[model samples]
Target: MQHTVIDGVDVYWAQGPAPMIATLTFGCGVRDESFRTLGVTHLIEHLAMSTLPRLHHEHNAMVDIEVTKFFATGKPAQLVDFIAAVCEALSDLPLSRIEKEAGVLTAEGSSGCHPTAGVLLARRYGIAGPGLAPWDGPGYDRIPAEAVTAHAARFFTRGNAVLTLTGPPPEGLRLPLPEGPRVVHDPVSPLSVDGPRWLAEDVPCVGMSLRGPSVSPVDAMGLQVLSHRLTEVARKEKGLSYGVDGDRASADSASTDRFVWVDAREGQEAEVASILWDTARELATFGPTAEELEHEVAGFREMIEDPRFVDGDLDEFARSVLLGEPYLSPAQWLEALAAVTPEQVAAALTESLRTALIVVPDGVRLELSDVDGKLVELGGCAAPEWQPQGKVFKPSLLARATSAAARGARLYLAPDGVALVDGGTRHFVRFADVVGVLARNGSRTVFGRSGCVVPVDSDLFKGIEPAIAAIDAQVDAGLVFPPSVFAGD
Candidate 1:
């Protein structure tokens, strides 16, 4: 692949066979959005491609944690036209269909499945910045055309984009992109908690996550080998899980997040968690075997050598470039992988364990008392007293409820906010902080801005419906999405 700069945008061109692919990527995604404007990038992406004519080609758009990409694959001429059209569309967005496109985004989000990266990142980084997913998107109803346009102006610019093609450059490829300064993603401030903590969710799977320094080729290869080893032991040898895999996400230029997970049967969650941790501990102690490393490296080399593996089209490279990571060729990457020793993998594993976070199937507890002191909780520091506006409700609970009684708990609802007063501490959630209120299984739960769930267990609190209604009233109608938004359709 050859690299050039056209009108301040980085361009990568490669020669390949028929059915060429052209992609225009911008450094704008979920990480660029604040909590109030969480899904604007996605909304802009959907709108930008809304007018593309689908003839003799296939076109699509994708918005992830850190980038938005529009791509088309077909004849070279069609691909060139698609790229030019998308750039023009971005330059002058058709906001006339804002509501229609938002509805489309809402339907898409409702049917979407949450990835493990979002779930774990929300825990590790909190919900404010790059860790915005795992929580419901900002209500599509609340987003206006002005907000979407403003977001597009900030991110969808020439300087912040890279156009990559896996075919000869098309003649008359006019990329009339918007002009703006290159966007530099600010470093995310991770939550203030020493981790390797444990969290149990309602899903029927067990996942363990670890964070470490920026990804090196060796660390990447080591994680691949370790994931394979765990999968072999957990899924093939013991028949304990249906699938086991590992994935990584970039937290910033300085750090990377690694996740290893296993999907098991309903009754086997604890066992799965135990085996996962045991495997992690063992791997951290001894690293992968030479045979395992060799096998994984071979697989890696094969993927790199695949005909479809266009270096410029790699999501990793796209993200890395935005984060200012040094570029390495496939051969250079292989050499680095070969140089990785078991001791180095072990050391990397050890560093990862220092701040690991284990997410287990809900209602299942894994014995992690040894790491209890390092556990992190969701939400920011306590809100000062002045934030509370008016008292809306104070529900009464049964006397035998020890969890609530012990803390002198009271549900305090206000016009602008809601607070759960436990002893002298107040976990106050403003209406703006609320993502949604869920009423299911005879219980009412309010999800906060940081994805923390404040549950009012039916057995404990009376007069809960009114409290829920009152809280719901304060939230904008458009922002109150359903609970299934989190559950993939």
Candidate 2:
């Protein structure tokens, strides 16, 4: 109900306390060109933040398939000026030719040659998705500047914005008047559905999902605590993921569903999958546990049991917001967390985690594929000379098309070429376009740009030692690693 126009967009600023929180929401239109330009909106987000020199410190940005969120924290006095700058930038949008070029370079610096970068490259080259989606589809070509300009004008309209502020609203923190033809649209919460899919390249890769019935909206307080409890349960369980957590009604809409995820080891795929399914079954079969039922009635008291609750800090407020118990008094958060029962916890989990998605890092391509499974015994691939910028080897796990020569031995191949090698203490290599014996030794571990361990040539051992060691270690680890577990014939 609280609303006003600011610089051609709608503004909804709320009053709270010491440190204010502002949420400025805007509708971003996807056209036949934008989607193809992966991270275009993300790029715009960075640019907008950079443009606002006032709040350069607390900058953060997030982009989902549909929405993009930007937030910055600062003193109340400077809030208006900070927000004003954002409004100005949005209102007087710029899409100059020089700016587009600069944006491309910046995007490249961040993406490098990673596969994800392919999206941006496609966008630059005018690739459109499936058809002419609101957002561009996938392609690998440069997009014309004129098309970029047209896309910007259609979206970024004043009628498509929701700006909210949570803090001590300044006397003059009113919405800025607009000088445009655009009108504000009524808020329409987005609909989210799950068609969860997962893919990981490892021996133990697997995926699982389940769904349960809805819970009482009144019991929202218990939902947050239940997530923490479930996280603890999964973390302690063997073969379970290191993290398993969920949120109840994270979005403002009534139709939205809660979700949780489990990241676990490969072999535990079936076990963990069954556990998740049974957990949901337990919910419908039995109501809340005694502790869970009690916690719900107490109204989430344990959450705010913090000693600093009396001081009224930002951290406390954030906790309250996350708990979905924001309307409750500080005492209520503390009260609810303590009183929740096992039954209530179970019920909440049943409601929210009924439909769960489980992702395991198992490399099994399919449950069934016995077409004489091909193995690219990588130890047999041809080795390349250590030239500058040298040669790049595909992991032994990859299906190589050629054979390799390692120590005068011809490695075997099963469709995938150089199968995974087991180099006990020694290392190994699966060099570029090469098969088994590609390089005799394992390359030195060099840190990639992302600080990940990537193999490189060493001064000694001619790289063969490392390759052999790598394959041996795989064998010793007892993992059903790659197809090339055995040496080439």
Summarize candidate 2's per-residue lDDT along 378-412 as a digit string, tens digits: 12112222221222233232122232322222122
lDDT of 2 at 160: 42
Runs off by more than 4 Å, candidate 2: 1-9, 29-34, 54-57, 96-151, 168-229, 237-239, 247-254, 265-270, 296-358, 362-489
lDDT of 1: 0.70
In terms of lDDT, the poorest run of 10 residues in model 2 is 445-454
TM-score of 1: 0.81
lDDT of each: 0.70, 0.37
